[model samples]
Every structure is written in structure tokens, then in C-alpha cells.
Target chain A: MIGVISYQTGNARSVLRALAAIGAPARLVASPDDCDDIDRFVLPGVGAADVTMKSLEEAGWPDYLRARVVEGGAPFLGVCVGLQVLLDHSAEGDVDGLGWLSGEVREFPSSELRVPQMGWNSVDVKSTHPLLAGVPSDSYFYFVNSYFATVGDDDLLATTEYGAPFAAVIGRDNIMATQFHVEKSGPAGLAVLTNFVNFGKAA
Target chain B: MLTTRLIACLDVVEGNVTKARRFEDNIVVGDVETVVAGLYQQQIDEVIFYDILASAQNRRIDLETVERVASRVFIPLTVGGGIKSLEDMHLVLDAGAEKISMDSMAVKNPELITQGANEFGRQCIVVSMQVKRVVPTAAIPSGYEVAINGARVFTGMDAVEWARKAEAMGAGEIVVNSIDQDGTHQGYDLTITKAITDAVRVPVIASGGAGTVAHIAAAVQEADVSAAIVSSILYSPRMEKLTTVAELKAELAHDYGIHVRPIVAA
Candidate 1:
């Protein structure tokens, strides 16, 4: 079964609904014990980075999730703040993130563009991966975040531009994440989640 | 590049979808669920569920309707009308709404905008203004003032100035509706829409007076708003030809050389 990690975030319901729409067996993972026997995991969040991290730590997610993704090499996906928390730090909450990926989350530098780049922007792929299968290049995805992740060139999967370029999608090894909300991104986004479900299930 | 959005505003009363002209002459179109599903089938870009009587009647927003309609909608769904406090915003967002819009409440208590933004991110708060044209005054130099209580009371707040304040107060987006042009079917008030759109950095949505496909196209190209909130143009059966969001998107791409996401038939 697919496990969705929901630790006091708002997007969990929409994420699960999207999964159900695609006929995938998924359940919310709210505790350490809920992380057991998961074929793949989705960490869905729509809250601030600091608050999400605190909630995850309070629920013993920092330790449990690291073991699941890093040590076990399980296929994993993160959405919005879920993707932000994978970095080393975020300017939003002034809190340290899970640091599973090597980077910091910073605010967009362009004052001309509005903060919380709220709308649909086109995603331009930088490199290819199994998780990106069927996701059309230049396809628009809905985004509602102020900070964008900063990582090495090798980890960037796709980038989108508002006034400046920001990482829209990222992947490294078994870890996959998107800065946009795939749950609300319509058909194109549904295809991304379908690929994630079937990515490593071949094992 | 981000494309212009076509949003459908469903003014619901009791439990059915309805439409009003200049905030009066209410008429029911269909059940909220059925109308919303039909939009989803045709692939409207976004939707707003405004409880028409909730603010005037002084009652809580209808959460059951929000939950029911939201279940059938896949795109971003925003809820408005009678959202007086953070608790009301919570109820709507928890009911599967992506954003919560405040009309009269935002003017009466502007702090709600900051509070809502701080607690639930700025992107969750939408400030919708109903504007009416008037003489230029010190309070409103733009000659367009804000009206509340369904256009029953006019506040001497300039539409352009108020939009700037709403953005500073943490409104992620602004919806500027023209009272004079509402339900007229002539076209959108491009003057007021352009004034507000040019004055703010955030996305602006123009509402009121959409007669035909050309009107919507003009709002997007001339006014340069991020989106247009249309109602009667799509609902009124008296129009020469019925228009769907699918047809609108296709026509936009063909006429103006704009590209919107394609929607498939359900």
C-alpha cells in the first residue's frame, strides 16, 4: 500500500483524494508506527516549513522518515513544504529542515514578482528520470509558495520561471519532489503521481 | 508563461446555484453540484462559491454546500461571503476550499486579512471588492468607490487605493467587480480594471459586464488582468449562443494567440 505522511499539514486530504482518483491504494501516515510496510511514501504539506518540521519532530518523523528514505532507499515524494523540508534550512520559518537533500530554501529575489508565486507556471525539464515519465515539457503546474529550494545542478529535475528561475521539480536517487501542488494540477499532475506509484513497485 | 484564467463565480443561495443583476433580481440556474460538475466536465480553470445571502442575513457560511461542491471540483476552489473571522476561514478551508475570499468583512475589519495571511499563508486570503463609479473625492480620487452589503452601502474608498492596501495587508489576490457594469452585458469596465491592475503587484480578477466571447478576450488583452470572473455570459440562456469554458479556451488560443491548458471530456 502507498503511505502518505500527514503531520499537521493541510494538503493531505487533497493528496489522498488525487491518489484515490488514480485508483492507488493509499492511507495517511500520522505516526511512527504508520510508516511500517510502505511500498512508497508521499510527504504532503501545505504549512510553513518551521511548523511542519516541529510537527514532524513532535511526532518522531525526522528520525523515522530518514530511516525509511535514506537508509532503506524507499521511493519517496514530497510536495510544497514537503519539498521545502527536504532542504537544510528555510527563510520562511527560520528553522532547520530534515536536511535529507543538500540545500537551503530561500525567498524569490525579484520584488517585481509577487511573493507566494500563486498560479500556474510552465515546468521546463532539466533532466530526465523515471518519475517524470509522461509529464509533458512546458506543462503548467499550480504553485503556491514563497520560498524555492536551492540545490546542486545534479539534483534539479525541472525549473520554472516567474521573474527568475526556481527549481520546480527535483530528484536524487530514490527521492522525488515537486515544488508545485500535484494534487490540484489536473491531468498533467495526476500523471506524475501515477509514475511515482509505479516507479519502484517493480521490485 | 502563465496564461489568462477564466473563472466561474457561482452565487449560491439556500442550496441552489443563482445569479443576480446589480445585486438584485435573483434567479436560480440549477443545483450547485450539477452546475459545478458540468463546469468541471467542460474544464473551467477555477471556481468561486459565494453565499449570496449569508452576509446580508448575518449567518454562518454554508459549509455543507462547500464540501458537497468541492468534492466534485478538481481545480482550485475558492469560497467567499460571510467569512467574518479566522474560524470561518478555517471551516471553509477545512471543507476542501483552496482559498477564502472576504468582501464586507475585509473592509470592516482589515486585520482579518493580516491574521488570515499569517495563519494560513497570504495565498489563502482573497479580498473581493465591489466598486461603483462616482465623482472624484479626497477619499476616492479614482472616481470609483467601494460598496458593501451587496452594494447597499458605499464606502468612500478608492478602488485602486484599496487594492494597494489589501495587498499590503496580505491579500494574495484581488477581485474588482464593477457595480454599474454588472449584468449589463455590455462588457467589463476596462477603465477601472486597468486602474486597479496597474496599481497592484498581485494578480487582479475583473468581474462584471461580460456579454460575449469578445468581451472576455478584451478583458484579458486590454485590461491585462490575470483572470476574468464571468457569470451571466455562461449561464443566461438568452444569449445568441451558449458558451462553455472548453469553447472559450479554444477560441482564445485561435483568436488572440494565447495558450490555456487543454481540458478533456469526462
Candidate 2:
């Protein structure tokens, strides 16, 4: 079973539903025991970073996750703030992040575009990965974010342009993350979840 | 690029879509699933279900209908009507709605907007506004006024001003509709729409006056809105049985040079 991190971030339901729709039924992993035997992991987050990180800590996830996802080499997927918490820090809550990946989450550059950059925008693939397999290049994915991760090109999997090019999808090794909401995106989104789930199963 | 969205709205009354069918005779009973699913097949960008009388009748959003419609379609669903508190918001979001919009209740207690955003994130909270054209009074120098409680209570507040306030309250997007041009088929009130769209930093959707493919195009080009709500015109027989979301997208592309999601052919 896929271990979906349960917290106050409010994204678990959609992610859980998407997992089921893609035939990857998951269990809500609120404690360390929940993650011990799970084959893979899905970290879903929404709302503020500090709140999410606090929730994660309250559920005793940071240390457990470090061992399970990083050391154990289990496949993982992070959505929205789920993707943000992988960074070293964020301007939103002015708090530290999970630091799983080397990066900093910063607010989008103020421009003609709206702050949230909310809408269906195309993601240009930068590197080929299992999670992106079967998903057409430049296919539109739903986005609703005011800040995006500023990560090294080494970990960036895909990029989307709103005011400026920012990391739309990121992954290195068994850890994968997306700045957009996959469940709300429609068919293109389902294809993404399918690829991620299948890739983990194969591994 | 964030292409314009074409949204299909379902007007549900007294917790029953069937009951409202008499007044809105164009809508068929038990067609919530069929209509929304059919629209989904045509690749409609988003679907919104409005619990028409939930507020007036002192009830809540039709969660049963919302759940039924949501189950039949995969695209994003937004539900509005009588969303009086955070619990009501949770009820609909749990029912599979991606976003929850508030109008009357939002005006009644502005804190609801901030609270909803704080708990669910700004993306999940959409503040819907209805604007009426009025004389250029000093308070609302823009000449467009805000109306609450189904347009029965005019707040003397400017539409543009109210939109800014809602956005400040952490609303992610604004659905600014026209009361003057509503159902007039003369297209959205471009003056107010453009005013609000230009003033806000968030995405704004022009609602309540799309009568033709051209009108939808005008909403995009003139008001510079991110989306437009199409209802009455789509239900008319001229629209080929109200399954014209794809057709509207096609017409916008071929005639007006605006493109949306490619139609998912049935």
C-alpha cells in the first residue's frame, strides 16, 4: 500500500482519491508504524508551509520520512505544498523545510501575472522520467501557487512559465514532487499519477 | 499559458435540481449527472453547481447533488450557495468539489473569506460577486454597485472596491458577474468587468450574460477575464441541446482567435 501522509494540510483526500482512481490504493500514514511496511509514499500538502511542517512534526513524520524515503529508497510523490516542504526554507511561513532536496521556496516574481498564477498552464519537460512517461510534452496541467521552488537544474524535471520559468516538477532518485495539483487537473493529471504509481510498483 | 476557461453551471433549488426545473424549464430533472457528464465529454474546463435557494431558504448546499454530479465527471467542480460557515465549506469540499465559492454568506461575515483561505488554502476559496450598474455616486464613483442576498440588498459598495477587499481577505480568484447585463444576452457588462479585472491581481471570471460564441470571445478580449460562465444561451434549442461547450471553444478559435482546451470528442 502507498503511504499517504495525513496532516492538517487538507490535500490528502484528493490525492487518496486520485491514487484509488489510478488503481494504487493507499493507507493514511499518520505515524511511523503506518510507513514501515508501505511500498511507496505520497506526501500531499496545501495551505501554509509552517502549519504543514508543524503538522508533520506533530505526527512524528520528519525523522521517519527521512529514513523511509531517503535511506530506504522507497518511491515518493509530493503535491503542491507537499513539493514546497522538500526545500530548505520558504518565505511564506519564514520557517525551515524538510530539506530532503537542496532548494529554497520563493514567491513568484511580481509581474503582469496574478500572484497565485492560477489556471491551466503547460509544463515543458526538461528531463525524461517515469512519472512523466506517456504525458505529452507541453501538455497543460493545473497550477495554483504564489511561490515555487528554486532548485538546481540537477533535480528539476519540468518547468512552466507564468511570470518567469519556475520548477513545475522536480525529482531526483526515488523522490518526486509537483508544484501543481494533479488531482484537480483532469486527464493529463490522471496520466501523471498513473505513471508515478506504476513506476514505483515496477521498482 | 493559462487559457480561458468555459464553465458549466448547474442551478439546484430546494436540494432538488428537479424542483427548480419548472422555473428553469430549460433544465431537465435528474439530468444533473447527464448534463454535467455530457458537458464533461465535450471537454468543458470547469463545472459549477449553484444551490439557488440554499441561502433564501436557510439551508445548506445540496451536497447530495454536488456529490452525484462530481462522481459523474473528472474535471474540477465548484459549489456555491448557502455556504454559511467553514463546516459547510468542508462538507462540499469533502463531496469532491475542488473549490467552494461564497456570495451572500461572504458579505454577511467577511471573516469567512479569510478563515476559509487559511484552512483550505487560497486556491479553494473563490469569492463570487454580483454587481449592479448605478449612477456614478461619490461612494461608488465607478458607477457599479455591489448587491448581496440575490441582488435584493444593495450595499452601495463599489464592485471594484469589494473585489479588492475580497482579494485582500485572501481570496484566490474572483467571479465578478453583472446584474445589469445578466440574461440580457448583450454580453457581460464590459465596463464593470474590465474595471474589476484590471484592478485585481487574481484571476477574474465574467459571469451572467453569455448569449453566443461571440459573447464568450468578447469576455476574453474586452474584459480580459480568465474565464466566462455560459448558461441560458447554452440551454436554448439553438445550441443543439445545450451540449455546446466544445462548439463554443471551436467557434472562439476559428472566429475570434482565442483557443481553450481541445474538445474531448464523444
Candidate 3:
């Protein structure tokens, strides 16, 4: 079963509903013990980086997630702040992230563009990955964020431009994440989630 | 590049979706669930629901309707009207809403914005303003005054100034609804819309008076707003002609060259 991590950060219900829409058997992982039956994991978040980290830490999710997904080789996905927490650190609240990927989350540089890039924006595919299997070219996804992840070239899966190009989608080994809201995004986003559900399963 | 967002605003009263002209003469359109389900199928970017009577009646928001509607909605859902405290925000958010918009409460208790932003993140807190056009005066330099209680009471505050304050107080977004243009189906009030958009750094949404696809295009082209909210154009049978979100987005892309999310076939 695919497990969607739930906490006080918000938007977990939307993610759960999206999984149900795709005919995927999923349940909310409210605690670390809920991780046992969850083969594929989806961490959906919508809040500040510091707040998301604190809630996850309070619930003892960081170590369990790192052990199961990062080291255990189970497929994992993160959305919005979920994606941010996977990085080494975030400038949002000068807080540390889960450090699953070697990167830092920083606010979009002072520019003419708005700070939190709220609304729909297109994603440019950087390379091939199972998570993007049925996602169309130039597909747009819902984005509501002030910070973007800066990852190494090898980990970049897709890029989108606000003021400057930032990592919109990143994947390394068994872990993948998107800076946009896959659940709120239209059909293209559902396509991404569908691929993620079938990603590591034996064909 | 970020595309312009087209949002559908559902003015709900009691338990059914309704429409009003200039925030009066309410007419029931359809049940909340069916109308929202149709909008979803049309690939609307976002949806906003305002409980029109909750605040005037002096009560909490209708969480039952919110929870029922949110169960089927996959896109971002923003709910406004009757949100009075942090507990109210929690109740609405827990009912599955992505964003909680504060109108009457925000103007009365500015701290609610900061509190909501601090607790739930600024992105989830939206400050919606009801502005009515008035003669230019020193007290109202922008020639527009903020209204509340379904636009029945004028707050004597300048629309542009209030927007700036809300943003400073940690409102992630602002929705400026023109009391005069609402339900008129003429067009958005561009002057005030542009002024507030210029005054704030966060995204501003132009609400009220969306008649045609061109009107929506003008809000982005002339006013430079990040998004536009429409009601009668999509749902009102009383309109001369009804349109779908797909048609609007297509016209926006084909005629106006406005970047909109491509509609995915159902």
C-alpha cells in the first residue's frame, strides 16, 4: 500500500484523496508505526520549512523515514515543503532539513517576481525518470512556494523558472520529490502520481 | 513561467450554491457538490467558497458543507466567510480546505492574520477585501473604501492601504472584490485592482465583474493581477450565454496569448 504521511502542516487530505482517485490503495501514516505496511511513501506538506520539520521531528518521522526509504530502498516522494525538508537545510527559518538529498533550500533571490510563486507554472523535464512516465511535455503544475531547492546536476529531474531556473523535480536513487502540489495540479499532476504508484512495482 | 490563474467563486447560502448581484438578490444555482464537480471537470485552476450568511448571522462557518465539498475536490480549495478565530481557521482547515480567507474578521482583528500565518503558514491565510468605489478624499486617498458584512457596511478604510497592511501582517494573498462590479457582468474594476497589485508584493486576485474572457485577460494585462475570480460566467444560467473553463482558457491562450494551464481531457 502507498502511505501518505500526515501531520499538522496541512494538505494531507488532498493528497489522500488524489491517491484514492488514481485507484491506489493508500492510508494516512499518522505515526512511525504506520510505516510498516507502507511500501511506497508519499510525504505531502504545505507550511513553512521550520514548522514542517518540527512537526515531523515531534512525531518521530525523520529517523523512521530515513531508515525505511533512504536506506531501505523503498520508493518515496515528497511535495512542496515535503520536498524542501528532503534537502540539507532551508533558509526559510534557518532550520535544518532531513538531509536525504545533498542540497539546500533557499528563497528565490530578490527579483521583480513575487516571493512565493503562487499559481500554475510549466515544468521542463530535465531527464527521464519513472516518476514522470506519463507526464506530458510542457505540463503545468500548481506551485505555491517562496523557496526553491538547489541540487547537484545529477539529481535534477525537472526545472521550472520563476525569476531563475530552480529544481522543480528531483530524484536520487529510491527517493523523488516535486516542489509543486501534485494533488492540486490537474491531469498532468495525476499522471505523475500514477507513475509514482507503479514506479518500483514488478512489471 | 507562472501562468495566470482562473478561479471560480461559489457564493453559498444555507447549504446550496447561490449567486448575487452586487451582493444582493440571492438566487440558488445548484447544489454545492454537483456544481463543484462540474467545475473540476472543466479543469478550473482553483475554487473559492464564501458562506454568504454565516458572518452576518453571527456564527461559525459551515464545516459540514466544506467537508462534504472538499471530499470530492482535488484542486486547491479556499473557503472564506465567518472565519473569526484561530480555532475557526483550524476547523475549516481540518475540514479539508487548503486556504482560509478572512474578511470581516481580518479587518476587525488584524492579529488573526499574523496568528494564522505564524501557525499555519502565511500561504494558507488569505485576506479578502470588499471594496466600493467612492469619491477621492484625503481619508480615502485611493477613492475606494473597504466594505464588510456582505458589503452592507463600509469600513472607511482605503482599499489600497488596507491591502498593504494585510500583506505586511503576513497575509499570503489578497482577494479584492469590487462591490459595484460584482454580479454586474460588466468587467473588473481595474483602477483599484491595479493600485492594490502595485502596492503589495504578494499575489493579488481580482474578484467580481467578469463578463467575458477578455475581461479576465484585461485584469492580467492591464491590472497585472496574478489571478481573476469568476462566478456568473461559468455557472449562472441567467447569463446571456454560459461558458466553460475550457473555453475561457482556450480563448485566453489563442486570442490574448495569456499562459493558462492546458485543459486535460476527461
Judging by DockQ against the true structure, name the best candidate.
3
Return the lDDT, model 1, position A134: 67
TM-score per candidate: 0.93, 0.92, 0.97
lDDT by residue (tens digit), candidate 2, A1-203: 88888776466766777777777778777777666569888887778788888888888888988887899888889998899999899988898999989899888765667777777788889888888986776788788788888799999999988777888999997899998888777778888888878875645
Candidates ranked, most accurate by TM-score first: 3, 1, 2
**By DockQ: ranked, best first:** 3, 2, 1
Best by lDDT: 3
Tens digits of per-residue lDDT, candidate 3, B89-109, equal 888987878899999889999
Candidate 3 chain A weakest lDDT stretch, 10 residues = A107-116
Q: Write the per-residue lDDT of candidate 3 for residues A1-203, one digit (tens) a residue.
A: 98889898667778888888889999888999867788988999888999989999999999998889888999999999989999999998999999988898988753577767899898888878888876755888989998889899989999998988999999986799999998888677788998888887788
Residue-wise lDDT of candidate 1 within B201-263, one digit each (tens)?
A: 778898988987788888888887888887887886445666888778888888877666666
Selected candidate, larger TM-score, 1 vs 2 = 1
Lowest lDDT 10-residue stretch of candidate 3 chain B: B67-76
Q: Candidate 1 has which clashing residue pairs, if any? A: none
DockQ of each candidate, alpha-carbon based: 0.50, 0.57, 0.67
Q: What would the per-residue lDDT of candidate 1 be over residues A112-172, giving only the tens digit for each residue?
A: 7656677777888888788788677788788887788878899999888877788889889
